[model samples]
Target: MAKIVLITGGSSGIGKAIGEYLQTRGYKVYGTSRNPKNYKSSFALLPLDVTSSESIQNCVTQLLDIEKTIDVLINNAGVGITGPIEETPISEIKNAFSTNLYGPIEMTNAVLPAMRKQGYGHIINVTSIAGYMGLPYRGVYSATKAALEITTEAYRMELKQFNVKMTNVAPGDFATNIAAGRYHAPIAQDSPYKEAYGNTLKTMDAHVDAGKDPTKMAEVIFKILQNPNPKVRYKVGAFIQKFSIVLKAILPSKMYEAMLMKHYEL
Candidate 1:
């Protein structure tokens, strides 16, 4: 029997790319989108809204009815929000956290039972290097991912005895539709920081527009899936982007802040 893999937000971008890649490798891939009716993919399409408990449960239950067991899960559905820290509304930040952090946590809870019963499984949380530092206007997005990263650590420890594995893949900037809904700059029109925010976003968009191919991330994920013992985290992207994680850890706090401000032209 082919192994079954379920991915959230698999209708487009990295999630879609990874689903296609795994399908070609002989895994039975099931991908979820908010509206699966319109999604066209080589893998099976299912409906899911990760922020809702009932939706996550239904998606997993429906998949299990046909597949019997789920061998792998990729929590790839996420949203990014960008805006000046002070002006960004609490409601907006909460929404970002809902999809990026809470949704994954809920999805994991839904699938762990099946993975545990099967005696072996793997979970990959699609994360970002934004979690590593407080980026110019993506503070909320970064915090949500950071929270997921810390949770991944705790889950890894707790699941070790159950033959379940979890790891985070923190890609730098990948070209995707994530940019469209992410720019939360309502106050950019009138705030004193308007010019700075505009400049910072332009710089951020340039990197995103020139991001590495999504296939690169898919390739790395495929390798991780095939491994018997994957590591705690995987970073994928340009040399400097990946290296920044190390630099942040070694550099002093003030120095790191200065470096970030300089890069984003703050």
Candidate 2:
């Protein structure tokens, strides 16, 4: 029997690449996006909006009603909110958390019972290197990914007995519209962080424009799904990301902060 795999935010970038790649490998792939009509792929398209509980519920319910079982679930729907901490409005911050953190949580909850009954399943959450290390102007986005990373850890432990594996894939920097589509909250002229926000946005745009191919990260994820025992976390993208992870572990707190400030031109 063909395995059924569902991916969220699969209309573009990494998610789309992964869905297409997996479809070629013979998995029965179902991908969700807010605007499914915008993309063409071999996988089936389902309408989904991670920020809305009703949308998430409707997607999952439709899948369960028709498919009966899901062999794998990929929680890849997320948004990037960029701006200095003080300049970012509370509403944008809330929206970021809604899509990045709570969205995955709700989706996982909806699928857990079915997976548990089926006796086998895999859950992959696409986090980011930002989750591992905080970057300038991306505080809220990073916080949301960090929350997902931590939650994945607990989920791995708890779901072990049920034979349901949970994995978190953290890619360094991939060619995606995330940076370009980043939401910038209103900042008052008197805000002290306005200059910092300008510098951070410039840096973000520069780095993202020169990011690695999204297919590279998608390939890593596909390989992980094929593994007999995938690790709790997998890092993809450039070697620099690995080096940064090491540096984060060995360097002093002040040194790490300095490196981030210098590299990001903040």
Candidate 3:
């Protein structure tokens, strides 16, 4: 029997690509979004607002009713909120955390019972390269991914006894539709950070525009699912970006900090 796979934020971007790739590979795939009807794809589409516990419960319930078990759960729903912290509104930060961090936590909790009963399951959390180090105007987004990384690390250890597996996928800039949904905090006319923020953002977008195709990440994820023993964390992107983690670890704090600031033109 084909394994049952569930993915959040599946309507588009890396999520959609993953769903489609898995579907072609014979996994019974289900993808979720608050408005799933917006996009058409080969994989199953379900309505899910990861930020809402009730919605997650309902969606998982519906999936369980039909499939009875979810062999893999991919927490892929996330948003990018970019702005100078000093100028960004509190509400924006709240919204980012609610969706990026809390949503995954709720979804993971919702599926644990079923996974535990089944005695074998795998979870893939789609984090990002930015999660490693704080970005200039994207600290809030960084914080959310960083938090998710920590959560996944802990869950990996906690779930070992249950035979459940958890993996954190830290991806670099991928050519996906993520930018379309990104929330750019409103900049005040009088805000001193506005000019620098504006200049740095263009540099950021340019790099993203040149990012690898969405299919590259989908392929990496596909291989991960097939592995009998997968690594706790997998990063998909350029060598320099993937090695950033090591660079930060070994380099002197001030030196590495300067490199990041130079990269972002901060």
**Which digits, one per residue and each the tens of the lDDT, describe model 3 over residues 219-241?**
99999999988998889998889
lDDT string for model 1 (22-48, tens) is 888888999999998897888888999
Task: Estimate, for each residue in 1-266, the C-alpha lDDT of model 2 and write its tens digit.
Answer: 88999999988888888988888888889999888898897789999998888998899889989899999999998898887787678999999999999999999988999999999999999998889888787888899999999999999999999999999999877788887677986565887877777777777777788889888877888899999899999888778877898899999989999999988776
Per-candidate Cα lDDT values, in order, are 0.91, 0.88, 0.91
TM-score of 1: 0.97
- Model 1 residue runs over 4 Å out of place are none
Q: Of models 2 and 3, which has the larger lDDT? A: 3
Q: Give TM-scores for every candidate, taking all chains together and pairing residue i with residue i.
A: 0.97, 0.95, 0.97
Residue pair clashes in candidate 2: none
Clash tally, candidates in order: 0, 0, 0
Error of 3 at 176 (Å): 1.2
